[model samples]
Structures are given as C-alpha cells and as structure tokens.
Target: MNAKTETPAIPEGACITAKVPERGTALLGDVVVNPYKLAPLTAIIRDGGQAISAAHVRVLGRGERGVDIAYEVSERSLWTYGGIPVFGLYPDHVNQVEVTYKLDGERIRERYQVYAPAVRLPVVANQTAALPLVEPIKVAPGFEHRLYLFNHLLGEIPGGRAFKWNALGGAAEWDQVGNNWIADSNGDVRWYLDIEQIHDSGRRDGLGGTMGFQQTRDGKLIWGQGQTYSKYDLLGRRVWQRALPDKFADFSHEIRETPNGTYLLRVGTSDYRRPDNKRVRSIRDHIIEVNEAGDVLDFWDLNQILDPYRGELLETLGKAAIQLPEGVQKQESTAANELLEGDLPFGDTPGVGTGRNWAHVNAIDYDASDDSIIISARHQGVVKIGRNKEVKWILASPQGWPERLKAKVLTPVNAKGEALAEEGGLYAEGFDWSWTQHTAWLTGKGTLSVFDNGWGRNFSPTKLAGNYSRAVEYRIDEAKGTVEQLWEYGKERGDEWYSPVTSVVEYRADRDTQFIYSASVGFLTPEKLTTTVLNEVKYGTQDVQVELKVSSRQPGSVGYRALVIDLARAFS
Candidate 1:
C-alpha cells in the first residue's frame, strides 16, 4: 500500500504513462518471445500454510537496525491460483530468517521459517485415519507407478456458471508422457477423469459441460456426471451397466480407485439435520466410499470430521480485530477502526451452525505427486484434503490483503505524474465495471506465476506495447507463502481485445505457457484483437489466431496487429 510515494523505478523504453493492474502499459516487441509467456525472475519465496511464490525481498537495509522489515511483495497474479491478488510488500515482523530443505531419492522436504532462518516452519500438521477397501478393478500389469488427483465432494459451480471454483471434487492420473485429468465441474474442480479414453461430451442434464473421466474408446461416449451409464468401449457402445437397487440414494462424490482397479464414490444428503444446526445441506457435502460397481462400501462427511481445530483459531480469527491506536489513525473516526481477520478465497463457510444452506464450489484439480485433491472455495479461498480426509491446508485470505482504505490515499502514482493515488488513481483495471474473471497458473525456472485478469476499467491512455487488456504476473515464494509482482501486459502488449466483461482463464503448464483466452460476452466487447504480438516480430507468424480478422473491414471492424520492437538488437 504505497501512499506518499511516486516515481516507481521502471525500465527505460518501458511504459512511460499508464496504470498498474488496471490500465496496462503497452510495449512494442517482435515475437522473439511470445511476450505472453512468463517473465524471468531472480528470486523466489514461500510462506504461510498456502504455497505462494514471490520475486523480490528487502535484505534488511542496513538502516533501521532491528526495526520492522517491510518489502514490496507483489501478488497481482494471486487469485489465479485460487488465492487473492494482494500486490506489495508490507510489514511481516520477523527477527531472523531460517530455511532448511531435505532432498531424498524422489522427495523434497523444505521447511522455511522467517522468524528464525535456522529453524524450519511448519506448513501442515494434521491427523489421518485409515480407509478399508472392498472391490478390485483390473490394471495393465508391468506399470511401474501411478499418480492421482481426487475430489471428495462433487459440488456445483459458482459466480452463476461463468467460471469454475478452485475447491472441486475430482481426480487425475499423471505420468511422464501425459496425465489424465478428471475433475467434478460438479462444483468448481473437474471431477470425472480417465487417462485412457475420452468419455461422451460429458455433461449433466445434457449441459454443455459435465464431470467425468476422459478416455479414448473408438469414439463412444460415456459421462460420469450422474454415474448412471455403464462403461463404454472405443465404439460408443456401453459394455457394462450397473443394477442399482430401487430405494438407494443413487449417487456419490469422491470416486477413488484402488490399485486393483476397484473404485468408490462418497454419498450423502443435501444437509444432515444436526442437533446444533439443522439446515446445512446435510446432503450437500459428504464423503461416501463406494465400489466401482456404484455400490456403497464406506462413508464420512464434514459433520463427522467437524471443525478439528475445535473453533480455536477459527473463533480467534473470527473476532480478532486489530485496533489501530489513536496516534496512527489513517481515517480518524470516533468508531475505533477494527480489522476482521478471516478472508477465504472462494467464500467463507458459515461458522459452525450458521444454518446457511449455500456452498459454492468453483474448480478442482488433481495433484498426482502427493495424491492430494485441491479445491477452491469462492467464499473460503483454498482447502486441500489428503487421501485420509485430512485438510492439509486451510488457507484463508489475509484480512489486511483487502480493503486498504487508509492504504489507498497513500497509493502513489497520480495523473500528470502527480505521484498521488487520487490524482493518478489507485487501480486502473484496463477496463472498468468487470467484477471478476478466470485465471491460470505458471511455474518454471525461478518464478511461480499467475495471470491476473484485471476486469475493471477497459480503457486507459497509459497502455504501453500491445492492444489493451491487463494480465499481471507474480513471482511466487512457495516456501515462504509469498508472491511478488513481475510484469503486467494488456492493450499495451499489442492486444486489440481489452479486458472482457467475462471470459475463461486456463494455464497450460506443459508447454511452460499460460494463456488468458477471454471473450466479449458481458457489458462491452472492445473490438477483439486488432493486432496480436505476432505481427511485430520480423519472423512472426500471422497464421496464428492472435489478430482479429474481419472481412468487410468496416469503420469499426477488427483488424489489429501487434507492434514488435527488438530492444536487445536495437541497441547493437
């Protein structure tokens, strides 16, 4: 929260005039690099329970002796990872910095503690239970190993269906060549997954999207959205069917498979009537263990696990409000400004017995490495559940990260280089009025990154290289649970399409590439892509779909091209 500062250090020939996260400064460059890939980084750090990556850090300036160490930790690309975007480095009081990492055959155990670098930090500590199995399926023999990502609760999508939530129930199988990704869009995470083949254009109630496994069987179609149809062969033919008992609840979530090829899904009612609170979708979120034949073998639910922390931190965080002393009052008001602590990324789960029957699941992704299932809570933020039903990570957003009323007036950068937030404006969302959009993740060499779709204001005179829509990146410090801003691109990046009112966000880590593929769906669609970053490159390829193509070429038709400038070669 830069208040009384201005004249930020920027590379020469960079954007001379523009906004930060909102109105992006455009740049000129040939396609030497896609420009949209990821920016290089010199540092990385991770902190807290949730894994975050940051780019820069203050090495304890030799000044204020043992004073508080405040650094600029940018997190423009945070929400893409199902987290929040809190750019800048603030006061994270710590006396020492200690880090320890262990590398075993194929495992890595790294502990990071900022208070004391000599000791390690505790990322996660929880109890786990054992689960028994029943059925067994067939797997091709001679397979060395396997990886899977599973979601326990097949939930629903939030934000009215435009985007998926991060906390979803699904599973994915990963290997060297490729991995089969299955998730339950049932909520936010895609649940249905099968690496071997592609199922029908999987969808529930015949919706365009569904949660099911992806397998290739000659072209047959089978979706696990409702778990009704039997398995299909390559020829679009059902090879096996299930004989469901009439009175059975007839459904479930968390479909985990055994090494022997057997699988099960968790089942439950919308909300179970509890003695303390009765209206919590007892049927909504439950853990049902079933055999591959759609038969129930075992079951569990949140009601069973119930707040393991026993309402200690949850309650403390709930009522924990930081009191700003009178002398340091940013906004002097008689009402003693207090700060509320909890900030869940997705949405906040009603404390204990709120009796609120609403839970929105956004997206789900399977992690084969540790066999953990990652889910996004649009209201809560992030929740990672291990195979044993242990919530390894319950990372809520930092209340300080958002609503910086006092932090705003101090935000630097004013109009005409005024160096004031008000004059220059606080955040210019390249486009205005956009509530929020999609996001993607990126991890490579030295930076853990995210693509922030600043969907607020669409137009700004300060765009640099391309057209005009903003996408920001952050250097993630997973070990320290931190993030730093790396770069911002939008119309200045030679893009014709300004930030869309609403669109999809996805990241392809395979090609070490991330993309922000949006559309002009909502409020205003600023003539999609006039010119992409390609046309500017001497060897650029126009065949690529970056530029907008309009045949009539009318007065307001789309026909934009990116302007490339090879800075490296320019000086030579």
Candidate 2:
C-alpha cells in the first residue's frame, strides 16, 4: 500500500493532544529529568484515514528558536484507545510543541501546549504514617538516598490498576512497577513515584528477570523487555532497542554495562528438537557483547563450551531431573513464538511449554578485576568463565549428586578460610550453600554476593526442614579451590521472608549498608498475593535500619529487582 496515494486530506481540528492530568505532584525532588521515569507527552492526529507519513516535535523555548525533537509516532491499534500518537517531550518543562505531520500531498502543522510537572514528596517525620498497612517498626533516621525498584511483574492490586499481560492464561492482571522511592534513615518511604511499567519474561518461571532495570552513568535506562534489550532517555522515549538472533532466542535474566561503552547480556537458545524428531527442553545459555548503540559485537555459547561437562551437569540435576513435572507443548511455531516474545516481556510460558528450562541462566556479572565473568544458572550452578571462555570453576551445593560426582565441583572452606579437603564441593546443606539463586556480583572485598531464592530448600530426598531466602556473601579463593561463607541476612527470619522467585542483594560500602529487596516474600500461596519488601540493614552487624514493604494490595502480587543509590548522584 503506497502511503502517499492511499492517504486522504486532513480534517479540521484534526491535530489534537490529550493529557492525563497529573493526579498530584509527586515529590520528584529536583527539576532534573530522571530518564528512568520521565513520561513522554502524547498527541493525536486525525486525517480522514490518511496515514501520517512523518511527524516531528519542535520545542519552543523562551527567547530562542524552536529546537526540533525527533519523535516516533504510529497509528493507535487498540480500539478502546484511539488517537494519533505523539511523544518525546522534555520533562517538567512548560513548553509549546509545534507538531508537523506529512499528509496527503501537504504538511499539516499544529501547536499544542504541554507541561511536565514536578512532584513534591512529604518528609518522613513520623513512622506511624509512613506505612499504615504494617505495624509501626522503628525506622532508621535521617537517610538521604533513594531506592529504585524493578518488579518483574506486579499482579493486579485491589484497586483498578491492572498490568497488560497475564502469562498464566488468566486475566491480564499483572504489571511491572519501575518505581523510584526515597526513604529516611529509619527506612520509611518519604516520597515515591511509579515512574514506568515494564515486563519481565522470567518472573513466572521461578527464574527471575534481568538483574538490572539500571540507569547508565549518563542517565539512560538499560533494561530487557523479554528478548529485546532497550534503552530509554530521560524523556521516557525509547531511543534504542536490539533483539537477540533467532538462534540466541531470548534474554534470560541479566544485562550489565562494561567499562567500555558496551553491555554484557545473558540470553539463551532452546534445543528442544533434534533431527531425529526427539523432544527435550535443552536451553543453551550464552553471553553476548552489545555496544552502546544496541548492536551485537560478540557472543559465547556456554552449551558448546560445556558440552564435555554434560555428564557432570546431568549428575548435578540428579533427583531434580527425575522429579520435574511435564508441561504443555505450545501450539505455535518458533517464528510465531518470536513475534510473541518481541518487545513484550513474555517468551517461554511459565509452566505450559515444550522445552525444559535446563541451564536457566539468571544472572551475569563481569569481573573486571580478573577479566572474567560470573554467571548464575538457577537449574545448575554458578560458573566463572575467563576471558578465553574457559570455565574456571563451578560452585554448587553438590548435595543431591553422588559423592563421586562431587569431584567435578569446587571445594569449600571453613571459617578460617581453610580448605576442607574431604568436604570439597559439598557445602553445609539446608539453605546454607548456593542453590536456585539469582543476582551474583563481586563485592568491594572481592567476595561473591548472591540472592539465594532457596529453591528446593526442602527437597523431598534431602528433607531439609526450612524453606527460606537470604542475601549471602561468599569469599571464593580460586587459587585454593574453596568458597567460604562470609555473612548473610534473613537466615533467622524463616519462611516469612522466603522469596522463591525474584530478589536482589546490594552491598553499599559508603553507607555500610546492605539492601535486600524481595519480589514475593510471602509463601507462594493461592489464597492471597505475595508482598515485596525493601530492607536496609547495618552491613556488618545486620542491624535493622529501615524497612519499606509494598504489595499490590491484591491477592497473589509479585515483584522483581531492587536497588538503592543517591538520587542526586544518579541524575547528575
């Protein structure tokens, strides 16, 4: 269809803009645009079914010539929401946009007034009023940092707020909350704004989503919406987006920026069918080097590299492999599957899928110190790959496997950092060692920090009593082939804090604090939804400094990743 020939003439009052008036000012602190949460202005154009060929926004500043801002607009597809699309606005600035759209044999111009208002948040002066849902706990006092949270999926709350996708084949009741919050030293939220909504593909699979909804040093948001990795500017406009190759399939759970202007993305390709018509869910993980502009620079597939060690992995799967439940096979083709997983945050359906989520890579962290990368595989174990792509070591609980198979795994060290020669590979059982974990990174002290979701914490064969989650730090001595547990939080909280799915652990040296954010803290229950909690604690002593917990206020709510940083530093 030739757009120019099919387009019709413009109608009177054809160009208009709609504003979802601000409910109230959220205390956004300053006038600086926080790129991670800026809302872009929207406009509509009606041209008698003539498509808008091209459109641009001209921002008119005081005493200055208009600055043209490039905008990406398309016809609205949803029937209920009908509007010609316009976006890419400057936040918190009152200005006039001279919008021009190329139509049938002519250019139509329209001027619209728009404003991005600033929000003034309240100071947390009282604990009782800070959070009214839970009991009044003594919060820390006089805090100055802000917390950014990216929940993989937010189940519909009691209120009318609803997310767009429902992977469970139920209602589209889940949403992604990319929110920013300010907390006092006592851990009470003084100000907050639900800046953006995102979708996390791995939320429902018991494997979490991207380890980051992180803002780059230059204030650009870098995140994964399923198979595609995208970047958005401060004005909430998607500036760049890149998808994995068809062979690479979809993003698993992590993406990180390199010292150079590039990214390390963890993604996977499924090998569910063979030439012989056999069916098996064999997910092969890979790490692709991506440039700042969202181009793939390089890639390394772990499956090919670790194929020799397949027997070892099979042994590690042991009881888990046998006990795994069968799921439904999707009726769609791979091409159709790709379309479904594209910009949206849904790839493999949680339970109803053909492939086994084997080697579910959930987190990737680059160790610049050693020129290596540490990856967390929820179904297997954490593996460190050197610059040459050599598997330096594999760290796991090594319990379910046969004693002889433990030789293939790494050894562990005691309190004194002394290697237990006989106890190599097998760490203390029952929620002590790493298992079904997410988010692994190097601490300032050169130890590995992990968010252990405590999956299979109470395996039937192992019969471990408790099922709980915790933020744990381990000192790994590659030279000695040993891993030592340095410290942990939530070990005493029991299942009350057992977040089996999404979570994060951040250790801040400047503030001597450890922040633990959980997406679903409550027991995975059907009667009620789960709650997410953000806890700030004294780093070394594990003293409770502050705690901010929020839920959808609806049954079965869940969230994803969380982190805290200085707001001023983040923006400036």
Estimated TM-score for each candidate: 0.33, 0.61
Candidate 2 on 373-415: residue-level lDDT in tens?
Answer: 8888776677788878777777785544333234546677677
C-alpha root-mean-square deviation, candidate 1: 26.2
Candidate 2 stretches greater than 4 Å from native: 1-138, 142-144, 155-211, 270-284, 307-355, 399-408, 420-431, 458-465
Best by lDDT: 2
Off by over 4 Å in 1: 1-235, 238-268, 275-358, 388-391, 394-396, 400-479, 484-512, 523-572
lDDT of 1 at 337: 22
> What RMSD does each model have against the real structure?
26.2, 15.3
